[model samples]
Target: MDHLACFTPGDLQSARAPDLSSYHWRLLAQGDSWFSNATAKLNAHANLLQELVLKEKACVVNCAGTGEALAHMVDLESAPDFVRLLSSPEAPVWDGVLLSVGGNDLIAAAQTPAHTADGKEVPLHLRLLRRQTEWGPPSAGVARYFSEPGWATYADYLRSNVRHLLTLRDQGPSAAKPVFMHCYAVPMPRPAGSEDGGLGSSGPWLYPALKAYALPGADWAAISRLMVFHLAQLLKAMAADKAQFPGLHVFDSTAVPLALATPGSSGNSGDWHNEIHLNHSGSFKIARAWSEHIQNVLAPPAPVGKQR
Candidate 1:
């Protein structure tokens, strides 16, 4: 397990509100339609809460995921509209807010493919397509990845959406509570004849220190680095906006970040499916990491003592 998983929800027991288990956790997972994933994690997290219920405890309730949650926000609408969608004081007041939005935004930025309502073929970003592994630098092909019809609009949308979410995080009574924000999907191996973009697809770009991504022949190590790159952008953005949102505290999900996805590595962080979402083991690991993140926030920083 990654060191991040070592954390446990210690003092959050006290932070529990009345019937918190019944409290709603409005999860907003954008990009590539990852609702099932959001719901699944919500279920897994809910199980933990269910156990707490017997102890007369409670946790956040969960909303549906994918575009359903964020549809209103990203609906080719105005920025204020997005803000209104997010910060509105609605029923089942949200306690914990989890987001996985930017992956789609980046995908849009990358100008990837689009299928018609009837599943007809549409143009996909040629930059992403690979006839060989030795493909290099930005080019007409690369333009598809870095540029698109809605690229500029999508980038603007992302910036605004992020700002709105942060503002909302500081709005409600549960403002100071936990906000579990997931980063964008890392590029990984995309199975041939499949476009789920879950795991195992290599990334769009790979720079040495700044970032890295899986390649055609990449081992696990390379894949893991890409995952971190995707995730890091979100974390870094949140940290940058800290001053704007004092009530919020961002979790470095990429903390103790995966070195690489080599088989039998100390941390099995990345290496599974390459894209954004994790596999069974990976999801649990992330859930555990989130639990720990919540624990860290509710409690004082622990002393890093030598464990006997």
Candidate 2:
């Protein structure tokens, strides 16, 4: 199972492939750390793009960066490379566009401190998790720990930015081409952080926030699962409304059965490399499932009688 050949925008632009015709599909990808390596400790060689295996050979030009928020990625002024490659006069007609976003945005919102560094209380709309005193009735399950107003704001932000991205695509050479995205697997709120000898470290994003809000350790996993479910549902809604996003396609990567991490482990456990990102094995599982879905969409099976 060979992976697709992926290159950065600079690499592709400086040295255009001598034979673009050789590849079955030419893809343009952009998003967050999932499409690029976020932490060195979590299998430096493994990211979504690197792990993706298509039935037909494809050359992927990736513009995604590590730790980039969805807001930043869609900002034309901040990230010009994506726009330049997709809409410029010299832009190629991409077969499809791959995206791995929304996760970072969710993480950013979830990790917001209840109080600011200056000792000011952050507004409810600015915080995803509610403090112990702010929790709703006990019957609400994981919903009790979250602020509805904040979740609503987060949902709206995701919808609008995705719309902006699609609108941008419509303005480019790849208009009406399939744009694929995927949902994330639920994560455990543990003490795990992606740091190996301090080369660079990140995460345990949910744990700190949960602890700050005085959430019980027993409910951490359910709370995390609920948040991911909400995010997944939002993406599904966007994909279903063809009027808003004509070529948008989202596959549920959460359907893949990766092992769950232990409740309090600080290092690699199950399929997770750290608190947020998947390890090599887990990424491979997701990439393979997502690749199958992409293949079914782009190249459906031939009719029973049409076989040669």
Best by lDDT: 2
Weakest ten-residue segment in model 1 by summed lDDT: 1-10
Worst ten in a row by lDDT for model 2: 65-74
Clashing residue pairs for model 2: none
Residue-level lDDT tens digits of model 2 in 41-103: 335426888878878888888887443332333556756788888777678888999988888
lDDT on C-alpha atoms for all candidate structures? 0.39, 0.81
lDDT by residue for model 1 over 254-290, one digit each (tens)? 5533222333222223523323334444544445555
Per-candidate TM-score against the hidden true structure: 0.50, 0.92
- Candidate 1, residue 108: CA error in Å? 3.7
